[model samples]
Target: MGPRFQNDDRVRLYREMYEQHGPIAPVVLPGDVPCWLVLGYRELHRITSDSALFSRDSGLWNQWPNIPADWPLLPMVGKQPSILYTVGERHHRRSALVSDALAAVDPFELRDRSERFADQLIDRLCGRGSADLIADYAKELPALVLAQLYGFSDQAGAELVPGINALVDGGPDALRGRDRVQAAMSGLLTSRREAPAAGVASRMLHHDYSSDFSFQEILEDMMVNFVAGHQPTADWIGNSLRLMLTDDRFAASLSGGRHSVAEAMNEVLWEDTPSQNIAGRWATRDTQLAGRHIAAGDLLMLSFAAANADPQVRPDRTSFTGGNSAFLSFGHGDHRCPYPAQDIAEGIARTGIEVLLDRLPDVELAVSAHALVWRSSPFLRGLASLPVRFTPTPTSAAGVYR
Candidate 1:
């Protein structure tokens, strides 16, 4: 049986193990499932790449009656089988759809939209002297962008934010929130089917798949995409902003105007990686990894957080700067995350940051940096709250984007 540890202790132990052991370590999960936590850069790459040896299907979790069946919010966003969770030819086809959508969209247009969103947010918070960065800025920005892409009305988009938060946080409250979000999404899916709009949901609805995706399948896809799309981006923005504020060198990099804020943002994604712990995978056959013996049917967890810090892969790894390209926050190989298109999302996120920095270069943290609370979840990583103080920028004469 797996040794029991408090959530806090487990997280601490995981971090310590990474520091002490290099990469792979033994982890005792609930129910005593003997598992190997892959923390090394190369090991993570190997484990995620060998689809034949590892399975993404939640067969083990699905069989557990106590766990919520509707836990994963993937099925409701698109018709594709969440490229991150499937294997073989199906995975290929699903990935192609996501790639094609990103490729079809104009990059400059997306960046402009991001800049406008950032301008509006800064207008609201700048000079206000105090704001909860998570609520006032980070959370809302990504939710709005995703909503716009999905053709949701502002009101509908607003309604879903709390629900998304609950789902990502995961607990008793999360179950309740999931129910609310699922219902809302179900209704929206039905309405869209009746009156399709020219957005992502509409595109998914009209996708010319060889096999027709069922209504439930479409709903599942939406859930995954919506939750994945917003939560992590929100976490990234909040965390990156906090880091930049605290680290003079990183902040200077942004304000110096020499290294474009865009490059700095890429460094953030590569370094911080909001999705700290990816979902568990089951091994199909005994496999050797990092000289450890593996048994078939054992569980394996990938720690992107740990991998991003590995010195072998990210040679210059540091807290503020370094370890950019080596970070595999997004899983590698066939099951890599397909949304927010790194190029597009990074551009959009950076454009927003650039606008904010341009307007409020002196913005600083309202609360002590150490006082900020880190959110706890086995699946995600981010701030629970970020209180910041800054002078508000004057509202642009231009109207907000509809």
Candidate 2:
């Protein structure tokens, strides 16, 4: 078995393994499960898309002791079981419901709401000179957007953020937070069902399908969607801001009005994807991947960071100046993220960043880059504290984002 990975050691292990061996590497978990970490773009894509061979069902997780049996996150309804864990027809049905609702909603409507939220957040931080990017901007934007989608009040949205954060960033106390989040989410779904709103929650409550979905099942799906949609997005926004503020070339391109901020946002998504590792999948049968033999029941973990950074796939990948590549920050194929509103959120974020750059081009990090603490979740990557020093941009006698 490999050395037990402490919370701090996973990133180092990932970096060292990626730097030494190309993308895919064999790893033995502390639990003695032999797993292949698929890192290369091609391999990651293959494993994630090949649903027949790799199963998302939590059956494999039974091998590991860390996961709880009554884990609120697991899917317990439909033909195939497990919330985010099921596969095949059941997964397809659940995904269709989400996609349909998202499709019915106009992206522009979301953009308008996000822009307003961004403007307010920027106004609050405008004269402060420095603020924690995670707290003030990154965390706030996504929560508000989610609230709008769910038709929840701003206060409810704000309350969900810390619980969501705690659930994803597992520690000794994560279960406590997870329990609270689960209960709150269940309550929210119950309320939505009792008093329907004109939002995704209402849509889900009324969604008609052959499969029967219970309140708990619906809540689990919503919770997954909530976390998946916001957490990584928030991380990407925080990381992108940090990168642009420090790198003059990138910052200049953003502020110069030369390259579109939309393009820059894409570059940020491609360059610094928020999610580093995806959950493990079990191989149903023997398989050959990257010239390695994988026995049935073996686990595979996809590394979005490694795939995005692969030189073979993204030549000149290190140069974040610009790129046309679509990053797998949202995953690929059957497992693709359901929230299509990201483009809307990104648009709003880009506009907000542009406003910041235009108003305060000389803004620099309040502390050295090294002093910024990176978030420790293996699944998510972001700065916990991104302090910056900028001459407060004069509240444009005109309004913000005008």
Candidate 3:
């Protein structure tokens, strides 16, 4: 099994494969889908950086046209009418639209919203001695913040997350989750058109930016942003908490004022990146890479998780990698995550988790690290629930939500 396909000890599997098979190893996926898994750090950099040779457009894939309707990997590799599926000038144009919408957002506002939401969420469970941080605190933080970016309230955010969660769950009923997300988005678009607001959703509907993309096209990009932003941001928060609470390095750094929450975030990104592998990129033509023969239209999976953890690179895991650009957490080249989403995601995770640590000073995991359940998603790595226990710490003279 590959990184995304593995439920337990995923990193170990990727490492074992890389050690045994060298950089690029051809492997069969769950449904007997054959593809080459790229596990070398430098090799992955080369493939992702040279996008011209390795196309993101699924239309270029020779096999997809003949693949069965229920191909298990379709949900992972399926192309949408969005930037995620386009390349060249078309990719640039759609990327500009997403970037512009994100640019309009204020990062400071995102930080404030994150802290506020954390306060509210923690306030609910701090009275009790225990809580599930994933479900109760970490999971919804990104969705609620994203909702604000889209000009909606927490009520709308709450309605949208369950469906998105299901879609990413990679189960047989993923379509039901997809349909729910679409319905929620359609309703949001209708609501914004009916009563315009100052968020991204309303702006997409009313702005002159509509001149670039049709209303439907705008919705497609927003769906991408929503799904993309929520999963990783939520995962990063959960992962960051696990690292900070359990890892001695983080504890020492934070206690000694040597590291900020952002440092912990970068460490997590470098170590256990939200998604172990970026989805399959088809070879544009026959080419040789890392001593392996490559055929046209063959699937190439970039193991960002494996690469970042490569011993040749990260020989010293204790060293800080905040300045390291070699870690492809946000990816590289034309397909990199939008700058705004990246910024907002980091801000959300850092600010939210930092707030939790400050408020719940004594919080610790309720179960052993090995006992925590990893979420099953083709595109993300996150825990299903982060159950935690802490003394019932009350807020200052100010109210709990304060």
State the lDDT of candidate 1 residue by residue for 4-59, as single tens digits.
12122443455578777658888755444355788887888888888888877655
TM-score winner between 2 and 3, please give it. 3
lDDT of 2 by residue, 1-402 (tens): 123222334545655777776577887543444567887888888888888898776564434455345543232211233356767787788877766655566667776676666766677777878877778778767767776677677677667667776766676667786887777777777787788778777787778841367776777777777777777777767877777766665656544563645555676666556777766677888878777887777778778876876666766645654657568877887877765645545654665566556665666788877676776555567778788777675564445431
Clashing pairs in 3: none
User: What would the per-residue lDDT of candidate 3 be over residues 362-393, giving only the tens digit for each residue?
Assistant: 78889997777777654577778888998997
Q: What is the model-wide C-alpha lDDT for candidate 1?
A: 0.67
Once superposed on the true structure, which residue ranges of model 1 sit more than 4 Å away at CA?
Answer: 1-22, 60-84, 253-260, 315-324, 398-402
Give the alpha-carbon lDDT of every model: 0.67, 0.68, 0.78
Whichever of 1 and 3 has more lDDT, that candidate is 3
Best by TM-score: 3
Query: Per-residue error at 167 for model 2, in Å?
Result: 3.2
User: By summed lDDT, which 10 consecutive residues of candidate 2 come out lowest?
Assistant: 72-81
Q: On TM-score, who's better, 1 or 3?
A: 3
RMSD of each: 4.6, 4.6, 2.8
Number of clashing pairs, model 3? Answer: 0
